[model samples]
Target: MAEPDWDRMMQAAQAGDADSYRRLLGEVGAWLRRYYHRRLPPAMVDDAVQDTLLAVHEKRHTYDPARPFGAWLGAIARYKWIDRLRAMKSHPSVELDENLPVPGHEEAVSSAVSLERLLAELKPAQADVIRLVKLQGFSIMEASHRTGQTMSLVKVNIHRGLARLSAMIRSRNDAG
Candidate 1:
């Protein structure tokens, strides 16, 4: 079958055409289902589609008639897909194998201790910025606020600190 003119349907829907709006929603739902099913797990596909549909409904007023409908729909669907991924990451539903060995935290702790020891070799300002912006994943501006330093200073400290750390590693390697 030929594809319907989604832009025209959406324009009609915007103009208070109830039947056209219903048809448009039905067609969009089908398209969204196909779109999500290919990317998400089977169990999550339906929820993703429904979430996209609701977003489309809520943001229908923002859709420009001059723009292609598919582009707008795709953008919303992509955002919803990313949201689903983030949610999954934050609360994974994977079943752990009982027979699988769980690694100890000793390696992680040792690495952290080694990193702190290396950071200590740098100036206090440089070490603070590197810890805040790199290790703790804060933005430069946030690090600046936390350290009472300007944004530019935070960036400079990070750059210098990393260079120093790299040189320290190289020197140790050459000596050993």
Candidate 2:
């Protein structure tokens, strides 16, 4: 199948074409689903998709016709993902069945795969620092010593690496 001209469709939607607008939303929603499917927890995926769509709808007028539609949509989508993360952190879910054993092997592997994919997008230095500090539970000082980087550099790399990973997640067209 041929790819839709998202830029034109969005422009037409902005100009009050109801049919084009509907088509645009449909396509965008599908794209968002692919974008979030692996990134979010399974239970959170539907809510995240709906939240991102709502954000896109509310911010539709802010989209620039001269810019790439994917980039614009990605920016909004990334913000929505961050918002969801923040909300989840602030309101951690309660365990419904404390007596039930949590089966973590599959979840751990899935998370690791996703982490590696995201890490592959970063610079070697950044990726190394993140892996040592974030994934391996190394202190900044320990990561610095192991990586032969200054403590401050280790901290900086971790921060930049995570930020880049988050920003690039929405922009990548790997959903296919």
Candidate 3:
């Protein structure tokens, strides 16, 4: 049998032909997995492939029938791969604090004041590095690159700043 045309397959799939969709998915899945495998770890390839397929399925209606199906599929796969990389690098974890009660109005105001004081103790550069790397979730390399500072400088500033903050917090707690 002759090789199936991708545009035709996509059109047929879009028209609700189950077999065409299945064939398109099977053909694209392997290519997508290989694409993701090159950009990500082996363990993430399958997940990237699945996510790409689901995205393609969900967004199929938006696909311009005039465009090549592989290109559209590839674009979706690339987006999903990048998203997975970002997510894996900084995966959000939910911490359930059952023991910690929500702060009231007065507590919130006091906590804000305390944080301001704590941050104010550090020099501007140190404070900026701490805020970028610790508070803003940038990696040291990212902080350095974003701030135009050397990685070593960023690391030193963060370390010293954190030590100073710890000492200040401890002293305040002890005094209180």
Candidate 4:
């Protein structure tokens, strides 16, 4: 049998081929394990591998067929690996035992939840794009990585979602 093609499998997976997606993820999991094995302890390697696979599963839609699939996978793997390293840190600059009350913290949290609800009113794709790009300050590529949206799709969703939100706010203000 011929060797499996990564890009072709990814494209198929994007087109809703469950078998292809499963095969691709299985291969990716193996690849991630190998990539992280040397960098992480034996206990941590599995977590890193799982993390990268989950990231890939989430962002598979963003894979541009024109780009090399390995590179895309590598980017996700690197990001996950770095996250693991950060999580493994034991040294802390400040202890968390100090529970100091900050002014408006409750208000800020409430407002943040309200904003999230407003975002949820958009289409799923639009809401995700807006939350990642506008609220989370993620770059287009980073948003693409997280949400698996093409660059154009991400931009268009943000534009349309923002416009809709503006109209909604205007209506609310006019009514008030």
C-alpha TM-score for every candidate: 0.52, 0.57, 0.50, 0.49
Error of 2 at 108 (Å): 11
Query: In lDDT terms, which candidate is top?
Result: 2
Which of 1 and 4 is ahead in lDDT? Answer: 1
| Superposed model 3: Cα runs more than 4 Å off | 1-4, 92-176
True-structure lDDT of candidate 4 = 0.65
Q: Candidate 3: global Cα-lDDT? A: 0.63
lDDT of 4 by residue, 61-119 (tens): 88998977877787677666556544533211112212223543444445456557667
Instruction: Please report the TM-score between candidate 4 and the true structure.
Output: 0.49
Total clashing pairs for each candidate: 0, 0, 0, 1
Cand. 3 TM to true fold: 0.50
* lDDT for residue 71 in candidate 2, whole number 0-100: 78
> Which digits, one per residue and each the tens of the lDDT, describe model 1 over residues 1-176?
11458899999988889898899899989877666544444446668888888998899998899988877787777667657644543332323224223442343344356567767899999989876766555777888899999998877777777667656654452210
TM-score of 2: 0.57
- How well does candidate 2 score on lDDT at residue 32? 74
lDDT tens readout by residue for model 2, 7-80: 89989989999899898889888877666655654455568889988888788899998878877887777677
lDDT agreement with native, every candidate: 0.69, 0.70, 0.63, 0.65
Error of 3 at 168 (Å): 41
